[model samples]
Target chain A: MSPTPTTATPSDVTPARTGGGRTGGLRLTALHTRAQLLETVRVPIAVIGTVVFPTLTMLFFVVPQPFADDPAQATAATAQISLFAVMSVCLFTYGVGVAEDRALPWDSYLRTLPVGAGPRLAGRLLNGLAFALVSLVPLVVVAWLLTAAALPADRLVLTAGALAVAALPMLGLGLWIGYGMSTKAALAVAQVLLLPLAFGGGLFLPPQMFPGWLDAVSTWLPTRAGRDLVVSATTGADLPGTTWPVLAAWALLTAVLAVRAYRRDEGRRFR
Target chain B: MSAPLVRLAGATRRYGDVTALDGVTLDVPAGQLLGLLGPNGAGKSTLLQLVSGLRRPTSGVVELFGRPPWEPAARAGLGMTPQETGLPPTLRVREVVDVVAGHFPDPVPTAEVLERFGLGDLARRQTGGLSGGQKRRLAVALAFVGRPRLALLDEPTTGLDVDARHDLWDAVRAYHRDGGTVVLTSHYLEEVEALAERVVVVDRGRVLVDGSLEEVRSAVPARRVRVRAAALPDLGADRALVDGDRHELWTSDADALVRRLVGSGAPFADLEVASASLEEAFLAVTAAADDRSGSRSATGVPGTSTPTTSTPEVAR
Candidate 1:
């Protein structure tokens, strides 16, 4: 039997058109962020790994040290560990997460949507922020309980803002690796890049104690720039003259690389 | 009249050296249900992707609602489920449906979509824990949540069992009943037969036939003649196959062939003549096109390589 031809009545089936604009884009971003966060939280190990590792490093290494006895050194150590937390969130959330997502068919579906990339990128940024903040809690608790770490209320707020700002470069770097490489390659690259960045940035040692040559190079690294900005904000220490510029340069470079990687992936897969 | 829901004019897509879609033209009017039938590597998926705006044509024009499909606005009324889709493992089925629904300005209720797809019970289950068939169902369900004017489904029921496939077909039928247009590709000819008002048979990146189901079924106008005879008759058949004492001949005019045999005084014990089925017609159409193109390219068709001879399978 032939199918009955039914005319499309506007009231019956016309879809509501949310024109792709700033407001719709923002709404989509919020929805994406909520969904992404729920997915991340369901995997307890992912959150635990990012949160526990940095806190444990501080508890086992920094709290027992004699320098942690001094309020200034303790505050600086806390700031460094917090920076480490932010870095962990950036690398794990965007690097490994994005790479794994790229391997899934859901990623292809999302990429083809009319809402464009704003929602996905913003959602990822929001997720990174959530993980970064969550990772800091344990470190803050450890610092408060076992060490002489102290920060004025206003400085605490400033330190939080500075750490977030500093994380931009790391997030961009993560995106570059995620979009440009396979999941396995991205995972290995993230691990390989993480430790060297942390060590060279003086997250494990004071910049003042670094040899002259190492100190000069460290001043130019984004991680070191981030470390100086956060430590100075919390402990009132002097920052290198190039700290802000170094961070800005790294952020700009990685952002460009990330965008290029995204376009390249899009062209190769969808074109 | 409004513009066609989808229009492709001489659209072609090439991947490296292989052309996935050759110069071809097609138009799907609103509210029409089209089934794209083809063998493996026949470019059905490629054609669907072009309509979905997931890929651009290397040359020629592709439009949705009369606008260039590359524009996001052109794709606003389009929904598609590709050949493969992996749902987020950690998200519950309900959550996945809801999240996808949220993208539309006004979407079908999540519960209603799940219920329609027989996924109500699995709503609370994590997508990763669900069976492959369940995942496939969910993926197809998500495509309808937005109430799109046009839907492109590529092998939507590949992993579904008989019942599941029927249930999915009911959902598609209801959608078409409501005046929704759809273009679906599938390996199951029965699936196409069940849902498609219009059928397009594609092979080797080109369309071999396009018509209504009945038109396509009779497209070849050929019949198969089977008989048991002690001696093989010298009949002019396009093709013939022999199995023991039974002989089968394929010809466009079965009546004439039979009369000729009877006149020739061939002693035939049993004889039967039957019109070609949709399956046979499909094979004949593709095979005839392949033979024509293969011979043409053998002489000289620039950039054309020798066509590989592989028997078409229903499941592929």
Candidate 2:
């Protein structure tokens, strides 16, 4: 028996047409970002690793620090905790995920499509931000109950600002790791980087607890600056003005490196 | 012709020490189904990537729809189902198709694309759980969702069963019927023989043959017949012969020799006839080139190392 050809009425099938310039780029970027987010957030490993891990570490250490006296120290500790969450989610979560994805052929496949490097990077940034947001839930709840940490109106805005700025460099760091390192090496390197960046940034302990030499070095690090900014914003405390510039510099430099690594001849290994 | 849907002018790609595609030039006319045939390292995949705009050529240029293939307009007009099993395993079959469709400027409805590919029932099932053949089918369905002007499929039927392969072939026929051009590379000669209007054969970094099926076959030497006869015949006694066998008959012309056997009343029981297939012709061409290459290397002649075999011309 011959198969019958199906004819379509105009209503059954939409006519294909060119999307306008802005609409096309935006829609493509949205699709790419959504896919990136879903791919990351849907995994149980990411949820446990990003959201739960940082909260668990904070509860173990911060629950013991008394909020009764020296409220300034209590506030400083809260800022440090928030920075820890962002670091784990943005750098650790995003890095490992993108590394595995790079190994699996996702970049090659997306590059073949109409998706550009900019939109692809944007989608990943948005996904990292979303994951970063979700990771804050436990930290916020735990900090409010245990410590004298309260988010004031302006403080909340500052926290938002810190997250936005901090995401830029972490996103760049994650992409660089994804494109620059081999899969096995990336996992090991991410673990190594995650621990030092988190612990040394005063996530486990305050920066003041460090020796003079270490504290000086920590301030120069992106993690230390990020934690300082978050703590200062969340609490009505003043941090050094140098903190903002340092974080910004890290963001800009890492972003350039990430883009360079992505387009590098050595990065085209999936084929 | 208005313009070829895909055109390569001296396109070349190389890895540090190895060349993938070397100065390949070809035009895939609009609405023509062109097949790319080659072995694993024959550079067919590289050629497909160049045409699909996945990578820029190391030298020369590749154009699609009369523009650089990587441009947004050109990309929107092209669709590719890559050789690697690259789809995210966590995504549902339906979501995968829908997501790929969303990348296009104006894509076909997701429901129609799914139903057409018989993937409606598997819509909610995750990609990881799908069988290999099912995943391949999903990849193909995703490529068609955009109604792209040019579809580049690399080893599209690798894991398909017979029925699935046939189903895919039907979909391809339907796609071509809609006036879309297709450039497909596959190790499956039968698939190429069935689907492609024109075939391009690549060996190493160069094109060994490019023409219609008949033209390729004509370029190949005539099929040498081998028959296990009770008694063997003498050379020139059978027209033309390189060697003979006591119980084997050799001839380029099978039918003429078969008639002669009946006329001369030769006793024969166990008889077998072997004809050269596209695969055989491909191997013969490549092997001969290798022989010429070795000979040139031995004599230390740099320019004459690569043998150039002209394909038999076909009158249009």
On DockQ, the candidate that comes out on top is 1
The collision pairs in model 1 are none
**Looking at candidate 1, what is the lDDT of residue B15?**
76
DockQ (C-alpha) of model 1? Answer: 0.33
Write out the backbone clash pairs for model 2: A79-A231
Candidate 2 residue-wise lDDT, A84-196, digit = tens: 77776666656776677766654667666765566776787677777777888877788777777666676677778876776567677877887777778778877888889
Q: Which stretches of candidate 1 lie over 4 Å from their true place?
A: A1-23, A267-271, B82-85, B220-316
- Off by more than 4 A, model 2: A1-23, A67-70, A265-267, B221-277, B292-316
The window of 10 residues in a row where model 1 chain A has the poorest summed lDDT is A1-10
Tell me the tens digit of each residue's lDDT in model 2 across B1-316.
4566688999988765567888899998767888888766767877877877776889987987677866655676677884437888787887777677777656778888878877788888988788888888878877777777778887789878899899999999888877777888776767887899898887666776788866654455434455545564442222222223334332345677667766667665555556654555455545544564332111221212366544322111
